[model samples]
Each structure stands twice: as C-alpha cells, then as structure tokens.
Target: MKGLKVADINKAAGLRLHRRGGEAPAKASQQQPAALSKPGAAATASKNKNKENAASAKPGNNSKAVRLPAVKAKPAVVDVPPAAAAVPATGNAADRCTESLKKKYSEVGDVDNESEDCRDCLLVSAYVKDIFTYLQQLEISAAAVRPDFLQSPSRLQITPRMRTILCDWLVQVHQRFTLLPESLYLTYHIIDAFMSSDAGASVKKSEFQLIGVSAMLLASKYEEIYPPNVADFVYITDQAFTAAEIRATEQRLLKQLNFFLGYPLPIHFLRRYSKVAAATPAVHEAAKYLAELARADYSAAHLPPSGLAAGAFCLARELLPSREGACGGSGWTDALEVFSGYSRQQLEPLVRQIAGLAVRAGDNAKYTAIRKKYSSSSGSMVSTWPELDGTGEALRSAAGLS
Candidate 1:
C-alpha cells in the first residue's frame, strides 16, 4: 500500500485553501452504495455510459477511469509507447491499496476510501499485511530509544533542550533541501536510536550537531532517490565538520543501532488511519502537521509512532468540523477501533496531548521551525488554522505536546 506523501497532502490542502477561502474542507470524494456489478449487455451499456460521462469531465477532475475486465475473460494486449513507459507515475501506496481493497469489499462503497483516482494501478503483493505486522513488532525492539533517553547515564552531555534545538534546525535543513518527509522523520529516529545504544556513550557535546548531520546523511541515503552529495551536507553546516567526519559519524550511528532504519514512522500510521476514518483533506493535513510536530518533542517519546499518529488523527477529527456524513457518522468508528487498535477512551488523553502541542505550536518562541514550515502556502498555512486558535478543555487537561 502507498502512504500519503507530505507534498501531496500539502498540495491538496493548498488547493482547498486557495479555492475555498478556508471554509470547512469540501467533502472527500465519496462512493455510493451500488448493486453488485454483473457482466452482461446491460452492464456493458452502463459501463460505456459511465465512460462517456468520465470523458466529458471538466479539466482537473480526478478520473480517467477505465472499465474493469470481466471475470475470467482473456485480457487484451496493449502496446505501451516508449515515452509513457519512461515517465513513471502511479498513485501513492495507500491509494493503490485502497483501490485493491475497494474492489474486494465494495460494501463499504458509501465511504471515501481514497482509492478512486488510482483505478488503473496494479495491486500490491499479498504479503503486505504481514509486512505491516512485522514492522509493528519491530517498533518494540531494542532498536528503539527509551523515553527520557537524555536523562540516561550513558549520554550525560545531551539535554532534551539540546535535542530539541538540533531537531528544529534539521527541519529547516530538510526543507532547504526539499527532502522527503520520510527522510526527516527517519533522520531524527537515527539520532535517538544511536544515542540510546551503548556505542554512542562516547559521543561528545562538540560532536552532537555532527551526529545530527550524519544521521540526515544516512537517512537520505536510505530514503531519497538522489540524496544530496556529502559536499552539500557539509556546506549546509558551513563546513563545521568536514565531509570525512560526517561519513564517519554515519557509520557510527548505523553500527550503534545495528543498521536498523526501517522503524515505521507516525506518517505511516496516519495514512492508514486517515483512510479508515474517511478523514477529509483538512483533517488529514492537521494530523500530518501534528505528526511532524511530534518529531521535535521529547514528551512525544511517550507514544509509539502508531499511537502518536492515532492520537493526532483522533484529535484532528475533534478539532475540525468532521466527516460526520462520511463513515460511521464522524467520530471514531468501530472500523478505526479495529484497524488502529485504539479506542475512544484510550485516545482521549493522547488526543489532548497532541492537541495541546498542535494548538500552541506557534506560541513557542524557542523552537519555531516546524510552525514556520507549515505556515507557508504549500502547507496551506496550517499553523494558522482558526480551529487551533482557542484553548479549550482538550488543550487544558494534562497540558502537554504533539
């Protein structure tokens, strides 16, 4: 399954922001309940009619929908043009997976499953569920850092505030390079995971920023198609550490963590949960903003990436005018409960915690990188949302972070 990309979400929200003048987000595309599709002359006629309607759609409409082949029919062969093959494009992973699921389980057609646009894409491998399960188990392994790792005896020099400063700086570096969101999240995870391991005990205060830069180097190598050259990373730091030092620190970080970099991120969880909840673009964008904010807070260490993602999503629905008409009447659904493994009761405190962080994000003077990053038009100026403009009971209780 494809995960939702930060860029895509931002672009989607940017469209709504400019077009709707920031009114409640227009409803996500929804599919209606339909009788079982059958293969026959009538079905064929109906399919042709739908095709004609789709063909006549206005510019920027999201579909160029094609008819699905009849069951057990011999498929026709088509010759692909060289240019079409060279220009690779497919829906994001979540969209493709949602499309696959929708075909198998059309009963939920009344909901916006987020798959309609990728109707022509191929389905993923059958073991994808097993992959998610394996990653979930990995989330608990020794590869992860403990909460309050800065207070541990092995790493005495680094402070929570120091880590916060480093992370905030890295967010700016990430945007300056226009790196993927996975790289940003993974870069910080590498730093924390390395710090937790005994090998990193020797790391000094002078080398702290070096460790951060190296972690980004390593993460970009893992996540980017064309990572920045070592020279670019070196220059980004004003050559404080030479390219050689960065390469050395990257090796140190990976060796300390036993080269484990595939730990799932909150963005991963948010994408899946958003579809399950039928969350609107606005709600999903809010969740994305909160999840990214979680990357910088030491307090967020208390929640696993999945829980952090789940919390952001749950709170977003509450904070925003929700998708009441989408699926299961708006709030947390039984389907979400089953898939996310989070109940309404379990999520309340977490929601408030993330909400507190999201609501007050712009107020913090010391660390404003994330807030500034989201305030731009590409982010749809999400940091300035009126929904987050108040201090409600949710923000009042157990005052905390995203």
Candidate 2:
C-alpha cells in the first residue's frame, strides 16, 4: 500500500475534527508602549545615572537582594478528579497521530518531491496499521467477553418488536442529545447484554424503558467527553421516571452486566472497513443507515459486529450508482473478509437481512424513527433516496437469497 498523508487519511476516514482551535487570537489595541519602533529606547532614556551610582555604592545591596523572600502563585483549580490525575495531558489518539505526522514531516525536510510523497505514504500506512492492529485486538476481546443469551426461552419476556421499539426510541434520544455514534452502539450493546444476563430475566416490561435509558446514560459517560446529564435523560422520557429511579436502574443494569461495557461495536468495524474500501460519503451514509436499522431488529442481534459491518458495507456498495472504479471488486471483498474475519458467503445472509431491514424501514411506518432520521438533511438524506428498492433486490440476488 502507498503511504498516504495524515491529513488525507483523516479526510478519508472521517476522523477530521470540525472544532475550532483554542481561544481566538487577541486583537491588537490602539494604545502603544513608549518604546514602540525604538528597541529599549524608553527604558534607556528613563534610567537615572545618579540612582545607578547610589545603588552601586551601597555595600549591603547584594545581601538585601538575596534576603528578598520568593513569592509563589497559587495553583489553578482543576476540575478533574484525583483518580484521573495520572492520565496523560496529551489529547486523544487522532491528535497524537497528527502531532506524530507533523514531527515526521519536519524531520524529512527538503527531501526530493518523489521521495517525500513516498515517505509520507509509508508513515500513513504505519499509522493506519497500528490503529487496525489495536482494533483487531479489541474485536477478539469483544467476542470473548460478549454476553450470551443464557436464559431459558420462556424467561425471555422482551419480544423482538419490543426491542425494536426500544431501539427506535433510543435513536430519537441519541439525536436529541447529538451523542456520538459510539454512544448509540454502546447503548444497544449494554442493553442487550444486560437483558440476556441471568438477573435481567425477571425484569418487568414496565421497567424496560428505564433500563434502555439507563444503558444510554452509561454509554454516553463511557464514549462522550461531555455526556448528557441524568436529568436530561429523564426529561427526554417526558418525566416518566424520576432522577432517583433512573440512577437506581443504572446501578442495577451495571451490576447485571458485571460492569463489562467495553464490547466491540459495529461502528468500530464499519470505520475500518469503509476506509479499506475507500467508500464515498453517500455510500458511507447508506452503510451507517443500514447499521443503525439493524440495531432496531432482534434478528441482527445473532450476527456478530464484524459480520454486521461487512453486510452493511456490501449493501452500501450496491446502493451506490455504478461508476467505473467506484465499487469494491473481489480483491476488496477479500480484504474486508480478511480484516473482518468473515467470508463473503458467511456475510451474505446478514447482508440480505440488513437489506430487508432497510427496505422495511422505508416502507413501514413503525420503523419510521430511523427512516425519518436518515431523511433529514443533516443525515445526508440517504434514507429518502429512491435507489434502495432496486439496490436491495440486487443485493439479495447477489447474496443468493430469494
């Protein structure tokens, strides 16, 4: 693989930070110091020759200067807790990656044009490789620690429709707070994992909403820098539950899951695979729409995150208009399979399921939340596009499904 620049990689991977840099530059004031344009002229002119002589004549001047007590400024108040005191002051992974890229560029200064591009490509490849390796480890760990549906069939009160409804509501809540995609995925994982546990078998249907919101709350805290407050969650619920009830439910859900909330999410896999495919924004949006739709359906729960991501990516490619060199060929599919550890054949069934889900979300009113969300301009309006119907059938045919 050719080395790519970090800026280019960031753009391709959708990790570009949209935020403005720290405080705006201070404006220049009209008032000027007396020494303007004449270096040290004001200070030199202000000095008294007599005072200098008088100070030099004093024999105890050195002792007096030394005797002056050192004054110290008080430390500024930091909002961080003592437990997080040991954390590095440096920013997140993306920021660190950018800094490393800058350092590499500086060190390679004035190199031949061709060599510089090659070196940049190599540096980018190395950075991406490191990130992919870390995600691979996480994928393995997530599979190992993933919660199982151990409860007897009779004990499972939460039906598929109920799960779908909960997920739909969560989508609205997620949008209301403008939470990160990771938070939404984590919320789903947390809720499902808790419900599948032994303790969650006895939870009443009335408490389902509370459990769902609490899961989202925990996910936000884990994935967001400024997570929404519990009161905000309560308000989103139209004050159906009190702050105390929500907190209590949060504790219960956490205990049921044994505090294992770090499971790998489909979004994580989607990011990596999309980069490998070099998918366009439209395709990426379509893929995300399919993935989010999967969250609402119980059938998707059986599929692992890796399989889900591959399926969504496959569907996204099909949905996009056919352009020369635009779609992933055999090599691309093989690369995704190797990276995600799921062959095309293995991913086909999930792909079909996701396609069906996407179609239904558009055609059916019950699944309208997800469809409506994707219809908005801010969402890229991927859901409202007319290509889904024909593309879905094509995806099904290609997947060897009826």
The best candidate in terms of TM-score? 1
Q: Which stretches of candidate 1 lie over 4 Å from their true place?
A: 1-128, 153-155, 322-330, 389-402
* Number of colliding residue pairs in each model: 3, 3
Model 1 lDDT tens row, 212-283: 889988998898766776777666666577988988888877777778788888788788777666677878
Off by over 4 Å in 2: 1-151, 321-325, 328-332, 389-402
What are the clashing pairs of model 2? 3-121, 3-122, 4-121
lDDT scores in order: 0.66, 0.64
TM-score for each prediction?
Answer: 0.67, 0.64
lDDT of 2 by residue, 165-215 (tens): 778767776775677999998888887777766666787778888888899
How well does candidate 1 score on lDDT at residue 102?
A: 36
Model 2 residue 342 lDDT score: 48
* Candidate 1 root-mean-square deviation in Å: 17.7
